[model samples]
Target chain A: MIETRGLTKTYRGGRPAVDGLDLAVPRGSVFGFLGPNGSGKTTTIRMLMGLIEPTAGTARVLGQPMPGAVRQVLPRVGALIEGPALYGFLSGRDNLRRFDAADPAADPRTRSERVGRALDRVGLAAAAGKKARAYSLGMKQRLGLAAALLQPRELLVLDEPTNGLDPQGMREIRALVRELAADGTTVFLSSHLLDEIEQVCTHAAVMARGRLVTQGPVAGLTAAVLGPGGHGRLAVTTPDPADAVRVLKEHGLTGLRADGDRVTGELPEAPPDGPAPPDPAELNAALVRAGVRVRAFGTQRPSLEDAFVRLTGEGFDVAG
Target chain B: MLRADLLRSEIATTFRRWRTLVLLAVLAGVPVLVGVAVRIQTGRHAGGGGGPAFLAGIAGNGLFLVFTALAVTLPVFLPMAVGVVAGDALAGEAHTGTLRYLLVAPAGRTRLLCAKLVTVVAFCLAGTLVVALSALATGALLFPLGKVTLLSGTSISFGEGLLRALAIAGVVALSLLGVAALGLFVSTLTDSGVAAMATTVGLVLTAQILDGIPQLQAIQPYLFPHYWLSFADLLRDPVYLDGILRNLGLQALYAAVFGSAAWARFTTRDITA
Candidate 1:
């Protein structure tokens, strides 16, 4: 678990990279940190990892103040920040061995075994002997992942684990994240890819301009955007647009718009504890009774992206 | 145990590199090349030709080659080599993006800096030994070994002479500790390994240059390399401790001053790379 109280960092002569923001990451949840480029996600992660000192405020990672307790806390927290920071001249196995040797608790006698196991887990066993500089981007990323998994960590904090990966590599990383979480390790990952987070995260937080826009369980976030009906849009295709609009208005729909052969109307807001929206069957029956030829009626439930856009405003880096 | 493991890793990663091997080989090769050149020259001319102080003394005792090699490499080659290794210790890792990973090892910045310093000092010892050993071997093949005469008109046994050579090599390595510490401090200031390396070597060159100018004599005593060659006094009969001690004290001062500076800079750094 990690918590922060107004954890802020301001570089010299510049704006704060991370403003006075509060954050809470509970244990055993695959928490997704969502944001755009330069949204201060990496800065916040660095502060928690004790890579950088916060200019103001403090962070408690694993229940201890950061940096002061980093030596004890970090070993139990596996992380792949930015990308795989691999030594180009060293073979993948050598890099892992070097990092493993740094951990005082790691048994040197079993270092080889641990290194090999880590490589195997990341699917880099075949290329384990090659110099890291010779590896492809995806291979290097996986090697970074392997370094993070040199031991069984209590938590995994991965920063954009699939930044430059192809579709297949992204899928592999996503699967690996799910597998780790399934094994009971809390995963706190920061990513610009909304779909990736939606696919794997149980809880998510959105950051914009160094502020937390919103954060909660994934289902709850999506449900928040579409009212209680859990659907974002409803559209009716009809030749008799006049009758369709009048009938839909009579049904107490608001924000109605009409075009040639089509009429769209916004349903009433369903309070969190309120009853569900009226069934489409009743709407169809009402339209039929009003002498309107309903060609088609379509409804779309809001996606994680749509909810995210509403939370962080437009132009979030959905693919980055 | 943690320190040893970290030290083992530092040494392993350092010595395994092709660049490090190349630097060592070049260091070890210098004595051989110098020995051969002196041998061919002496064979053609009847010991009338003069070279470096140790090369000139080789006709009397080949063991002086160790002294000569240490002396010859002290000014430029050795410090340049030490500068490269020390400068690259931290900055190279930063350049390659491995510094962050090393820190994530929770290798506390202080511990990591100390580990890097130990590795560089180890290189200084190893580099000096290679030159001394190669020179000793080449000198034995080229000249005779016997009771060595001291600089102050006294003689000592060959065994004592070997012991003195080892001591001299050690002193010579200690002479570069200042440079190593200084290089590490510069490394902490920059993420570019090349920039750090160039800056360190440039500082050494500038110090040596300043030490030469008569106008800079007032400041020369404070420079790290000012008394580098003072190890020559160890060959004196009474074992001139004044200059040697001063040289060592100056090195210690540089190490203490620059070592703390490096630690401060490194520990507070943001590690943006």
Candidate 2:
């Protein structure tokens, strides 16, 4: 678990990388951090990891103040920041062996085995013997992931883990994240890829220019902005548009638009007794009562991208 | 343990380069070359004659010039080598984006710096030994082994001469430590290896120039490179050990201060790379 109360970090002569912001990451859940480029996602992660002291306020990882308490929490945390930091001269096996020193309980053979398994998981098993300098960019990214996965710490913080990956690699990484979370590891990852987080994260936090826009369970997020009746994108093919319009008007809905065969309308604030917006049951019953044939009446949920745009505005990296 | 891993990784990475191999070869091979050159020069001076007179003549000249060259070169070149190696210890990691991985480990910044400093110190001592051994072999082959004369015009026994040579080597190592510490300090400020190397060499050249100018004598002692070769005084009959000790002590102080400064700066650095 991690928490920050009004944490702020300002670089000299530059905009504050992380502004006054509060954050909370619950234990045992995959918490995705979403933000745009230069949006202080990495800075907040760094502060949480205790790599840099906050310019103001306080942050705690696992109930310990950052940086000062880093040593205590480090044994229970694994992280991959920016890019993989490795000695290019050493082979991938050696690189793992080096970081394996952090885990004292694991012996050399056990460590190697763990490292080996991690490399295999990341699809870098074949390149384990090669010097890191010889690896390709995707290979380096995989190696970084392998290093992060070498041990199951209580918390895993990864920044942009899928930045340079191809579709296949991204799929592999997403599956790995799900697997880790399923095994009960709390993953706190920051990324600019909204779909990746939407596909895998159970919870997420949105940041903009170092400020936390909103954060909560993904389901909560969907309900809050996506609106009731499942963020209506209904593809209703009604036989009587005039009758449907009259019925919706009677319900106090407005902004109805018709294009060819489809009619779209924005639901007004839900009535006190109503079950959220665009209730499929209510609409179907109303149409049936009106003697109108309803071909399609499925609920429409906004894509995570649409939600992100709604939350952070256009031209921002909201997947962070 | 993480520190050891970092140190091992650093030593391994540094020694793997062709440049390191070439440097080691040069350290080993240069003495023999100097020995052959000394022998040929002695032969020319004697016009095909060889004896104690020729040997003593060559020995006297080689001890001063060749040994002096080694002393000056150790501080000048060896420290630069140490600079290149130590300077890259942290910055290169930052440059290649591997510093974050290292920092995120359980090891603290102090521990990381300790590992890097220990490795740099080892390299500095090893490099000094390389030069000393090379020069000693050359001195033995090109000239006779016997009592040696100091720059101050006093003579000392062969045993004493060898001891002095080792002492000088030790002093050379100590002197380079100062530069290495300074280099490491500079490394914390920048991520570019080339910039680090250039800055280190540039500082050394400036210090040497300051040391040479007569007007800067008052402030020269404060500069790290000023008394670099004062180890030569160890060979004096009366043995002016005071200056050598002072130089070594000054170098130690600089190492401590600069090294601590490097640690102070590094622990607080925002490693975005």
Using DockQ as the measure, which candidate wins? 1
Sort candidate 2 into its docking category: acceptable
Write the residue-wise lDDT of candidate 2 on A36-75 in tens digits: 8878888888888877778999998988988888777877
Distance from true position, residue A274, model 1, in Å?
8.1
* Docking quality class, candidate 1: medium
Per-residue alpha-carbon lDDT of model 1 for A1-320, expressed as tens digits? 98899989898997888898798889999999998888889999999999899999989988999978988999899999988888788898998999888777678989999999999998999999999889999999999999899889988999999987899989988999999999999999998888899999999998888878878899898887655445555689998998888888877777788989878877767667978666777888989988889899977567888877777776675322
Q: Which candidate has the top score in lDDT?
A: 1
Q: For each candidate, C-alpha RMSD in Å?
A: 2.6, 4.1
lDDT of each: 0.88, 0.76
Model 2 sits at an interface RMSD, in angstroms, of 3.1
Tens digit of per-residue lDDT, candidate 2, span B1-273: 333555665566567766666766666665566567667776677544343222334445445434644654664677778878877777887888777776776656787777778878888887778876776767766666677777577777777777777777777788788888998899899988778878888888898888899998899889888777677677667878887788888889989899989988998887767
Model 1 TM-score, 2 decimals: 0.94
